[model samples]
Structure formats: structure tokens, C-alpha cells
Target: MSATRSALPRQALVFLAFGLVQLALDTAIYVGLTAAGLPVATGNVAGRIAGACLGFWLNGRYTFAEGGKTRLQRRHLLRFILAWCALTVMSTYLLASIVTGTSLQISWFAKPLVEAVMAAIGFVVWRQWVYR
Candidate 1:
């Protein structure tokens, strides 16, 4: 338990580091999809797909790589997808709701905010369950 506790901060930093890359990929995909005439929700799906594919490898090899010294596996990949899919749905709902209901200008800002919130949630779930 003490060992796990000690590792948490480092894990979080690694997670954040990779998450920033994934976030940029997702955001770029979202913007491109939207520019191509897709709905925001559809764009969200595309972005999530792109990010999750990239994230699985990065998180597996780097972020959660210490767990059991485990290398990437099919089972881990499956769990990663399931975990990210859940996060994506949640963040998308938050983003969509905020952009639709709020009177704030620059709705694009909502994506980053929603992504940050989802990353926090993802770190807990990924650390405790998916990667554990």
C-alpha cells in the first residue's frame, strides 16, 4: 500500500503528460471533423476514437507500465477501450450540455474543460481497475 501510494504522484504526472498529447490529437480531430460538416457529437466520436487508439499504447507502455512490469496485451487493450469509451461519453455529454445551454462565448473552450475533468476521472479508474 505504501509503495502504491508513493507511485501515485508519478503515475499522475505521466498520465497528464500523455494526456496532453492525446488531448491535442482529439481536439484537432474534432475540429477537422466539424469543419468537414459533421455534427459536434459525431466529431466527438471521431476525436475519441483517434485519441483512444493513440492513448492505449502510450498509457500502456508509459503511464501504467510499472504495474506487474506488464507489457501491452490484448486484454489490456480491451480494458483500455472500455475505460476510454466510458470517459468519452461522459466528457461528450458535459461538453455538449455546456455548449448548448450556456450563453458563454467561444464554445470551443468547453472541450478542454470537459477533457480535463474526464482526465481526472480517467486517472482514478485507469489506475485502480483498468491497469491494476
Candidate 2:
């Protein structure tokens, strides 16, 4: 049990890797959609939903390792949803404000950066409040 506990940090690294993969996938999808002339907001929302689902799956399966729980499981799922929603709104606003307010023509690239930050925030919140 002690050794198992000690392995958590390593497992966390794996979780982060999985998260990054999902993030990359989400970004690619969003960019592809936008390049295809889809509405930005539509692409954003669709990417968010897909990324949130993938995050939940990976975190539940690999990060927390509590996917089998019943009652507690439901609560974690709910918390994940709420947390994702909050982070999404914050990231979206931040990206939009930075892009429009700043003279940087590359502001569109800020979306993935914001998402990464929000994902880190969500991981901390989930670990402290939702998982344990």
C-alpha cells in the first residue's frame, strides 16, 4: 500500500500526458472546423464538449482510478461538468478579450493556450474537491 501510494505522482504524470493528447486532439478539431468556415462559436462549443467528455473519461479511468464507485462517482461526474463549464467560459472570454483588445494578429492561437491553463486548474480542483 505504501508503494502504491508512492506511485501516485507517476500516475499523475501519465494523466497529464493523456490530458495533453486530448487537448491536442481538441485543438486540431477546432482549428479544422474553423478553417472549414464553420462559425467560431460553433466550433468552440463542439470542441469543448468533445474535450470535456474525453477528459472525464481519461481522468476517471487513469487519473483518479475511482471509476467503479457509484455514489461518489456520480458526484465526481457532476463536479467535472460544473468545473469544465466554468473553465470554458473563463477561457473563452480571456481568449476573446486578448485577441480583440491586443493588436496581435495571432490571437486565435491563444485558444489552446487558455485551454491548457484551464485544464490544469480543473485538474487541481478535481483532485482536491471531486475525486477525494
How much lDDT does candidate 1 score? 0.79
lDDT of each: 0.79, 0.72
* Cα lDDT tens digits for candidate 1, 79-99: 877888888888777767765
Highest-TM-score candidate: 1
lDDT of 2 by residue, 33-56 (tens): 767877556666677888878878
What's the TM for model 1?
0.86
Badly placed stretches (over 4 Å) of model 1 are: 102-105
In terms of lDDT, the poorest run of 10 residues in model 2 is: 63-72
TM-score of each: 0.86, 0.79
